[model samples]
Target: MAPWGSAGKTTPRFLGQFSHYLFRYATWLPVLIAFNSYVAQVTWIRGPSMYPFLNPQYNESLRKDLCLVSKWSPHRNLERGMIVVFRSPENPHVTVVKRIVALEGDVVRTKPPYPYEHAKVDVGHVWVEGDGDKTKDSNYYGPVSTGLITGRITHILTPLDRAGRVRWWEHAEREGVQKAQAS
Candidate 1:
């Protein structure tokens, strides 16, 4: 009877330990997931798409203004003129930032003054161009797969500003409001 009593006591202690660990993991799981899900992740600008705005080679100070790409609102189709971070279609391992020039089915003129051969927009793909023509972007590769887009440019987080400002812009042709004549 005494031996049986000792075994019973040990069983409760083991159960308590297990419960503590379970609770700890349960509480931490959501936070870990949220941290990765929509939070601003750091990335390096590889090329000159952004130019004087975000240059890795010329302005060493830019290394401080790390681009903050958020995955929060990516499921929605990107608006024209929004800078975005996306996986390179030619190279999945690489990511590039460029502006949305045209959406699916939108006519984009590609001629002189423009640096590349003319191409019409394709469905399920959008035209993206580097603000700088010389950089690697849709100009070099043509339209990009919508699926490749990771997220729109939300903000740039740098220690320079205490507030962490985000320098983003919208096009004159605001989203949802189209030119009546064009339609």
Candidate 2:
């Protein structure tokens, strides 16, 4: 057999190894992509909006919760009561986490002490609020665009149950519209 024939057989083994590595990398590619551009895994709750449910400032003993926020679905099909992370409309560099109170084409009317002036949520936009009434949310800043939304909270890491996934109903107790009207 010619020397070239011997090299031909060796090429297959190299290619096989390369293919195996590619397969392994493919599995993590989505995660890597999310980590790199779409989702952020580590976040700090700066304010008390999350309140007793998340950050307990009064106790100073209760552990704070860190969560993963996925910006991938912000514009797709965001539903009410979902925990979302978005940029502050007044300031793009700042990020905030709040619950979706209303969506596009919805009328948002809140009472005094809060100034929205009976705003109408526009298309490609959403209304967000903190569970804590004291928080500065849509009541203060008004409706924000879907483009401003970065992601949804998928998991919470803190206290006893670390890596706990955040569910929809866990934050659905408050009625956004009703609360707005009541305010």
Candidate 3:
């Protein structure tokens, strides 16, 4: 015991307890980081690019769609009409969500201003388009590399009335392509 009734003894004990507590939980840090980085994540969608199927209203009072994006889904197996979140090819820092319009080796009809009347998705890439024709997408940037795709959106988690697995039936119908089943 010291003059202050064990004041000298308290500091070491407090530090030891803190070190032990930190050691016990430090092991979970990597797992938590990996889960968020490679497993699944919740994302807030904020734009008119997806429209009717996603954010249908322009009013700020209406909540935006919150979606569950699965990083584990293999981009190579992506089919036409599946919505995916990918890093913009023109600007790697920005992420864009779009529907897979065509897979590798598939022929895609191009819209105005694109040099070719039709374009074939090159190897290791896929053609993506917005649900709305007015949105900027493959029609503007062309086919995007698969490596830029980060995740496949599986479910809408917010706005209870609209919450459910995201389906591409309408988009497929509009594109004249077969709708893909949710994976």
Judge candidate 3 at residue 31 and give its lDDT.
91
Give per-model TM-scores.
0.64, 0.69, 0.78
For model 3, the superposed segments whose C-alpha errors exceed 4 Å read 1-9, 12-27, 59-62, 169-171, 174-183
Q: lDDT, candidate 1, residue 106?
A: 73
Q: Rank the candidates by lDDT, best first.
A: 3, 2, 1
lDDT for 38 in candidate 1 is: 71
Q: Pick the candidate with the highest lDDT.
A: 3
CA shift at 13, candidate 3, in angstroms? 7.6
Would you list the C-alpha lDDT of every candidate in the order shown?
A: 0.65, 0.71, 0.78
lDDT of 2 by residue, 86-157 (tens): 889888988888888887776766645565557678777788888775678887877888888778887777
How far residue 87's Cα lies from its native spot in candidate 2, in Å, is 0.9
Query: Candidate 2: where are CA atoms >4 Å away?
Result: 1-34, 57-59, 176-183
Better of 1 and 2 by lDDT: 2
Error of 3 at 16 (Å): 7.1
Weakest lDDT window of 10 consecutive positions for candidate 3: 174-183
**What is the C-alpha lDDT profile of model 3 across 119-173, one tens digit per residue?**
8778888888877645789888989999999998989998898899887654543
